[model samples]
Target: MNTIKNHIGINIFSKAILMMVLLYSFMTVSARNLKVESPNGKISVQVFNENNTENAKWFLKVNYFNDGKMAETISSIDLGLILSDGISFTDMKLLKSSKPLLIKENYTMPHGKSLQRHNTGNEVVFTFENKEKKKLDVIIRVYNDGMAFRYSLSGKGNFTVQDELTSYSINQETTRWAEKWNPANEGLYSSMVGEKIQQEEWCYPTLFQTKDNNCWFLLHESAVDGSYCGSKLSNKEDKNKYKITFPDPKDGRGKGESLPKISLPWKSPWRVIIIGNLNDIVASTLVDDVAPPSVIKNTDWIKPGAVSWNYWSSNHGTKDFKTVCEFADLAVAMDWPYTLLDWEWDSMGNGGNLEDALKYIHSKGIKPLMWYNSGGEHTWVSSTPKDRMLTHENRVEEFTKLKKLGVAGVKVDFFESEKQDMIQYYLDILEDAAQFEMMVYFHGCLVPRGWAKTYPNLMTYEAVRGAEWYNNGPEFTATAPVHNTILPFTRNVVGSMDYTPVTFTNSQFPHLTSYGHELALSVVFESALQHFADRPEGYYELPDEPKKFMREVPTSWDETQLLQGFPGKDVVMARRKNNVWYVGGINGENIEKNINIKFDFLDKHNKYKLRLIKDGKHDKQLVTDDSVIESADSVDVKVLRRGGFAAVIFSIIN
Candidate 1:
């Protein structure tokens, strides 16, 4: 009987030991095993998804300083789960505990770029089961160095939903949420001391629904510096939202995937704040400082001052080269540099020949900058060689031929937006252009990303709401100054903007602003390749003073200053080129006010030539210029109604 009892005890002990061993094995397997080493620091990403759970969660912990210090933690809602009423929540809790969790999921970075392991955290995938029992996969990628964060929700869905959302709980009475989100990092929260914090709400979109329904969301916050700009692969429109959908329809279904769509209301792209300091010029300057130079080998191709003929010069008309050359002559005689041959100049069979146009433009001593669709076919061209178009394999070859043709530069159009691949495409084009010595102009694109420093060949990018709409109405001119004010604080910080300034004549187009406001744009807006987008007759019609000011105005500046203003309100900016300082100011609506102008940047011992442009009483649309000689100090000036001013300050040599 004793022996039998012993056998039973032994069996019980063995079972207990087995159970403990199993538990230990499961705990070990569930712990986080992946480690990311980044330039800024190291972080461990833990992903968790279970069959019984309603949602998937991701947790990021930094293993720096041997102890986690300065670690940031945030969570996102799983796109897989169906909200009770199809309503998605921006604020979702991330799973966390003293111990680690287990997660099993598969994902590929939407863009083809290789994923980097970083200390802040790397890409993570979360899966949620919707009410319909469909699995939705969401990707949360965190960049190192607090640049920004990107979240992509892609799966079988009725609509394609792409948004960048941020949620923060503030300490009430201790912090002001608005101040925290502004350009300045210091605010009520930084100044206050308290235990209980208030919950603050602030969220804005970076890029959304362009003319194409493919939506892109950019995170300009510190978490994801201006690194990734999202774009749609397909050009199809979302019938419900009237926007373009992502993931070209052709690529779906072949990879064991169903067509994915996003169906969430998104905010417009917000000015991303990647740096805490207002002087965060490093990223902005990198475009010029880091990118390779233009493909044109000889600086001789660049005339210091010449006018350009935008193929749009004819407004898609049958006007021959003779008529356009006349305009170029007007610019050359006036000392403006270079003329532009917008798109449709390449296909001689349809409109003009690339080689012939180049010869004519050079004969007139005006460098010619031709246009090319980065990817799409020109509407005017019928027999364009498919190989010459902007396809995956032929872009480099086409650009190489243009370089060989002695083309000064190329204006790339119809880029659309920042898809992961498209972002890389822009960089790729810049890299290739560098190899061939060609200058580049980007249109129908998002705001600049400081590529100017890296790729000096990238002369300009058209992201502004410029005078092109003047053909629409006067309201555009009026609203332009307001938009300009907002831009310097937001878009201009990224890089150069091609606002195609100085449309002196009313195209009788649908415009919202006055003609004088258009002229003022020449100085208020900054572009390396500033455009005079009006008939030469319009410029000649200006009074001698205004005309001389236009003739002497320089497009490129060595330094820039924001005197004062607000977005969608009023703005005043001063740019310096050579020895002259050109100041331009504008108001959104009709208003009279006096501003104190500071000449602090000028040498006190030097005298300056100040040429001021202000609205004329006889014609609100026309600007009158006044010239004066003044010593460096401060000047108080009175501006007219719905008016602004411009000044040229130069060292007067006696």
Candidate 2:
């Protein structure tokens, strides 16, 4: 009897000890924190399981250097997705977490805010499994300027993405600058308190400023390819969260499906948040850094420069051959390398046919860009040369014809959709255009998604409410001043913005912005194919000083810096090309003010020669001045209401 009791006691004790050990092991594996930090250690990201409920939920926290210590900028951002088969990644169990890997690389772009870029970040991957036993991996990367994360999935069959449950949650009330959602992405950015924001769709590259720490952050996406449709921020105001939303079924004029259909082993586009000061938002190339490198091996033929555009001056300009030649002449007189012949070229007859116009334009030592309507069911505009780029075979035939005709590039317009098929259309055109050694620009399209890095031939995208609105209605005149000031902080921060800037004369409607303000657009806006919107007569009438400045201004930059100012109030920007720096400033208010100009961006030990053009005593008048200054010097510049100023500074070399 004693031996039996002793044996039973030993068995119970051993079983209890084994059960505790197994429970400890499961808890240790199930709940843990994974972290990655920026190279500079200024930014850090943490991912962890929040609870141990039957349906698990993971959260992310992003911290940045605020005041004197690292502080939380993003409190709790939910990260996950769901598939059509009801496989919920939102309810997942941790499988494994990889060690943080150092990612560093140096790459150069043909033309952008910065030609040379050093990309460095620390990356970590967290693997998880759902109730269905499907695998999902979340990859997180933290850079000095920002942080990004993406989802990866693996399976053996095709799957449809029902929806993404990922969302950004802001803990504090902050000031936000966001554009109302539109397929063409042509809305103006409006400033509002975070609590007052409407529960609606919003555009990417949105700007926000924290009230507590004064930290600035931008929300945008990168690496959006044909496999996924472009997404927008769908605000859930009551919850203080912004969810990732696919296009509506009514998008593309109700043409194709909005949700993404994919094969196994798929990765979603990166959800990027640029964090830090104003300078960090303006000067960072985080967009291109996250995108794939250039796939076009031989990029020698791709040249980015100023262009003389005709559509702004006359809506039907390209239909008349005489007008086409005049625009080409304008390009030559300005020493611009390219001229654009806009819509209706197929109906050319006044001076010559389409071929004859191209011949005359080429004879003047200039390349010409032609416009085509991106035809399908999307737009009602019946512009000619339509339906030529809808199919791959059609694109090949048209691109082949254009290549043989000595055309430099094509400005394909009227995309107006964020559907997967339309996204594929964009990539197909870019790939085909590159095959023929032709450059491409998109007009009436969605905002850029960092595709320029992958296709250098993609020079510019017109996704802003640009100068063309001057021809559309009277509303643009009143809104032009504030709108111009906001773009440098929002839309233009992501990619090349082809605003077609620099218009000095009236189009269909008069501009309320001052002449000085018009001149400043050349520097404030960055585009590989910078379009000069004025007619030949308008530019020819300018004084020698202003004309010379416009003639020599570069469309591309080696470096860019935000000197000072704020959104919807004013802006001062400095851009460098080779050794010379171009500085531009604008006043968004209706009252005149004196702005302090700083030369601290230049070399402190050396002096620079400054050539400045600013508003005179009145808004319509202009004045030019020349001076010499060093980095320690500052100047008080007077600008009229709705006026601006531009300056050229270069080192005084011995």
Candidate 3:
């Protein structure tokens, strides 16, 4: 009887030991490392999970390569969010990951950097669940030029997105260019080392150069519609670790909630990270790739072109009928498609009235663009045409009147918010403008987030410290040169920028850049309705070469290439419209240099006529020359300090 009892005890002890071992094995299996790679295998995203009884977390590691060799790694990126239900996903467990799926898209964007874009990539969806059994999905896309990820939540009822815990851990040794956070997004970009950056709110499209300077990345978001709030980056928690943050409660005149409140079955905008060299960053269409496809099927009415604007030279010019007609004549003279009648058109008087001005503009066979205040107390300037676009009813009424008058588009100004409500307001205006078959240009507004493709009528947006700043104060004079060079790598990458460029003369203050620099801007900057900032006299007085260049330069391009140079120092960019290529280069430093421009991108089988214009001995003079060249040829042109150049190359063999 004693032997039998001992045998039973031993059997029970073995069973207990087996159960414990099985539990340990199950926990260990839950921890996983999932990865997805770009098509060329040059970039990869590896997700690391730590799942245990004591600790559970999910983060991402982004790896980049150069010449098939590992160049750098964005070490750790924390990801998750919380809803109003008090359920935090910061410690959620990864349930499973889907196999890599292929994504291929071919689309056309007439107003973008490249008219024809191909979005090819691989995507993986990682599913996770919190303790409450609520599910969340993190969908990642890996493209040849970049990568993006977004959080998705699904259910039935409404929920407030209380917080987002997404953070990017950039290496402290990296170099970066970021602007201070502001609703208008009009600020200068400052280049600095990652560790030395101030712990402040930074705007989107923040640029980073790896510690080795072998790779580049631009951090921005896309597909931000009414359902979401626009975001900025903050490093206050830990400098060098930039975390996504929503708009300030003080923005939009302190009118709307900063934290987004929405219903279930929703997804956040893609947190886009475009990575590669300067050429890749300049030519990548990843922003438009992830954006929602066009909602307007009939795109026949949309046209991108250059415009003659009045505000830069004459602030109150729109109120004078004669001045409005003068700008209209300038548009016709320059072969521009449209002329803008800015501010106070409702009270036009001199020589005639607003009706007479519109009639005169139409008689010149040029379309007219009108401006209006965005309304509400968001702006201090009590500009006229206010309160006419606040509601959909008002927009329809106003747009209807403008449409009947044959207006080409409307420039809406003074939108000082990025909250969900303001975001919705922007969409509403776009929708209304499209309904009337009129294009839209947003000024005093937020930067583009792939909206131009979704709403093709969105001609351009003024979200940079553009030439208009020359009229505002003396600060622009000191910063404009470097600012111009940095924009091609930063702001202008994502979409069309209405910089109101090309001013050969002074506004309220003088520009320190040369005439060659001013001429280069007409090519360097891309805008659907490229606004010529100078007055009629400023452009009419230009020498034949510069005037002819401005008159013929196209606003939209079929292709774009970054030949050489660095941010805030200099840049040489080439843009192609059809078979002709327009090249623009700028020297941002305070000393002269020789910029070697290669014509290697041209058709090698054909000889071409190159009309080259460069800065002369003085900041105010320009020199022009013509030559026949082939793809193998290169020109070493001297560029003056705070100066630039522009060249037009077309096939001469034809």
Q: Which predicted model would earn the best lDDT?
A: 3
What is candidate 3's TM-score against the reference? 0.96
Cα deviation at 382, candidate 2, in Å, is 1.8
**Candidate 2 lDDT over residue span 350-456, tens digit each:** 96999999899889999999999999998777899899988889999999999988999999999878888898999999999999999999998988888999999
**TM value for model 2:** 0.96
Worst-scoring 10-residue span by lDDT in model 2: 25-34
Ranking by lDDT: 3, 2, 1
Please list the Cα RMSD from the true structure of every candidate, rounded to 1 decimal place: 12.3, 2.3, 2.5
Tens digits of per-residue lDDT for model 3 on 1-654? 999999999999999988788666545545444788999988899887545542367888898888866866578788999879787887776777898999999998858788898988999998887888788899999999999999988887787889889999988888889999988999999888944677889987899998877889999999998888999999888888999999999997788889998777899999999999999999998998999988788888888899998889888989888888889999999999899989999999879987888899999998999998999866665898998998999998998899889988999999888999999999999988888898999999988899988998998999999999998899999999999999999999988899999898898998999999989998888888899889999888888999899899999999999999799999998999999999999989999999888888988899999999999999888899999999999999999998999999999856
Q: Estimate candidate 2's RMSD in Å.
A: 2.3
Runs of candidate 3 with Cα error greater than 4 angstroms are 1-33, 50-55
Candidate 1 lDDT over 1-654, as tens digits, reads 999999999999999999888655545544545233333443233344343223333323322121343222212212222232353533232322222122222221101001111122244444333344444334433333222222433443344234332222111222211112221111111111234322221111121211121211122322111233432211112111111222232221122112223333212121132321222221123222212223344433332232454432356421355555666676776667677766555444344455666676677766767666655422223322322435545767877777776676777765543444455567777667666666777876645654553455667777655656554456564555455555544555445567676665556553444455556677776666766777777777877777788888876656566666644566777776657788877766566667677777777777777766676663344555445555556776666554567677778787
TM-scores, all models, native as reference = 0.59, 0.96, 0.96
